[model samples]
Target: MENELTLKRFVDIRRNLGYTQVEFAKVLDIRNTTADIERGRTKLSGKVVAELLKQFKINPLWLFGESEMQYLEPSKTSVIPKVVTVDSSDNENMVLVNAKAAAGYPQNIQDTSWYKQLPAFDLPLPEFRNATYRGFQVEGDSMLPNLKPGEWVLAKAVEDIAHVSPNKIYVIVLEDAVLVKKIEKAPNSNNVTLISLNDSYPPYRIEPQQIQEIWQVNSKITFGVDATTEKGLLRQLQESMEELKNQFNHGKS
Candidate 1:
């Protein structure tokens, strides 16, 4: 009976919120077919159940038919959690401003302008918590099995650079571009080194004074959607290689 309730209510709740099976699967990070779940053909794993509760705030009791709605209304004894939702389209319009780059990096490419606006959607935004904002496009396979290429991450902003700790990921805005790296302070200088989660890419150091600003990524609010497919991977690779060759030629000239 409890299992039945979990299956039935899970489908009902997601549909009520206007999410298609594919959209809901993406949100849950599940790589399964939605039809399997909806038709009760597949059993929900504890991990999947946990993800549903965490991502959507679905009530377990309610999902199991011990309660009324998919979510409980806040009451004297019930604690209401905050949720932040971000839409991809709104972020697409955000503006990127100018900043300095490293020396001998090419003057013409150093000072360029671009704009990106993030898509708008409603998610939980907790009040009284500090938020950091930085932009980065996923690059390598280190964070793979989680983040993929061409996916964008919007991180929360942190006020104190000195407060950064080890093993935590951060979205850093340097003089030239925004990056996602694990931050560690340099022993001798006021600079911090950005280490890639993937070991393949070597870490790079940048002076604290050189950075215009830094933003802590909001993992809960930060989500990635597919922008490229396997079929396009080769074309993307060719274009990237060509661009690198051009840059190399320009530097030698």
Candidate 2:
């Protein structure tokens, strides 16, 4: 089932955007019938959502209640970031890990030359220079909707794995593949489970010993989106709407 956009959320968005009901609807191409919904005559539709996001590059998470930030920065407005840089010691370089190299990261974690050969770019964020950061191009949908493929994610290196928090996402560097998954304590004391956001894929356990390196998922950097990105945005909206409807029904009863 897909998520839905709710009437309350619609009003919130209108107010947040500093637009009257009609004015917000105007931009969403729903100006005509928008009043109907406002007067308890109709409901917000997917078409309006499609137009809203495409026109304003609004973050679906915020619009649908998944995130508080509605307007994503231009660089990360889309599902993918064009470039990622890792801040180096002495505050000079941001390591850029391309997909090709990221696929082989586990094997090269201990290789000094390989790390140096990784591309470097300058990042202006002052906080980035404070500690080591690695940028990885997400290559799979295991962490879908929230973390999409082609998007860039930054994580700070955890010097000691003991401090890992439950249910937090982390980059697990394994020998053959590098994974971005949520961490949970496995049944086996010696192993840990790596969970995927997309429930279609089952959770699996892994021995921490197999992990060559781990980084906590910090921030996501997005570039831009296309026509197809609407599918994701709509899905998020639908899910939020479903929750809202359930709450309303529960209250009425």
Candidate 3:
């Protein structure tokens, strides 16, 4: 059964790309669902083969089991050197990088001694457990309301460039500087688009080779807020709003 073997190879391709049936379906732009096709309820179409070639460069010969190679060209995946510090109990601690340290981070990233010297502490949060994380202090207004200056962002290391999801915020480590921005991958290209949330800034494209490392932003820790002053401001705003409402009602009456 040549057709059965082809179907099996097709399933293998999806698995190698780290996609589930549902995700593979979306990538293939399949209307009948990949689960149905995989189960032999629906036939795999020629369009799928062409799309796979265009997007991922899946080899037709390989898909049909004629060749041993899976892709015409190897997928471009980056392996970032992750250096983590462990506590006395053998648990990994999240490293803290201030503005000064962040500038030099790209150069010293691979050095174990350099990483150990940076401030490291165990974050008790369950979400950050069992993963290498780093806290970067936000510096600029590029991200605006979403991320503020002096706030610390906890991010997880993204090992592969292929795994960078579109429209997600990441701390991109470059040779010159480390930047925090939203990422968008250009289709069929090695260039990635960086978008700044602040309208004053414009989107820019950078080659994958220019990036040293990428970190997916998980959460932010904000400081320097006076809670009492904030509460008082809120009360004043509420009183002003009520006064405006009373004036409007009086005029109507």
C-alpha local distance difference test of each model: 0.52, 0.65, 0.77
Candidate 3 backbone clash number = 0
Better of 2 and 3 by TM-score: 3
lDDT of model 1, residue 126: 27
Q: Please give the distance, in angstroms, between residue 231's alpha carbon in candidate 2 and its true position after superposition.
A: 30
Q: 1-253, model 3: which lDDT tens digit per residue?
A: 2388788988888898999888889989987458877777777678988998889888787888777767765544453645778889988887778777888898997888887656665655445676788778888899998999877787899977877887688999987889999988878877888999998999999878778888999777664443124354234334543565576678779
Comparing candidate 2 with candidate 3, which one achieves the higher lDDT? 3
TM-score of each: 0.38, 0.51, 0.60
Poorest 10 consecutive residues by lDDT, candidate 3: 227-236
Reference-based lDDT, residue 92, model 2: 52
lDDT, candidate 1, 95-212, per-residue tens: 2111222121122222322111222222223221234233345555655545565455545556557557776777565545556678899766566788876677788877675554
Q: lDDT score of model 1?
A: 0.52
Poorly placed runs, candidate 2 (over 4 Å)? 1-89, 186-188, 224-253
Please give the RMSD of candidate 2 to the true structure.
21.3
Residue-wise lDDT of candidate 2 within 77-144, one digit each (tens)?
A: 12111233344454555565657788776666666677776655455455556656676778878899
The predicted structure with the larger lDDT, 1 or 2, is 2
Colliding pairs, model 3: none
- In model 2, where is the ten-residue run with the lowest total lDDT? 76-85
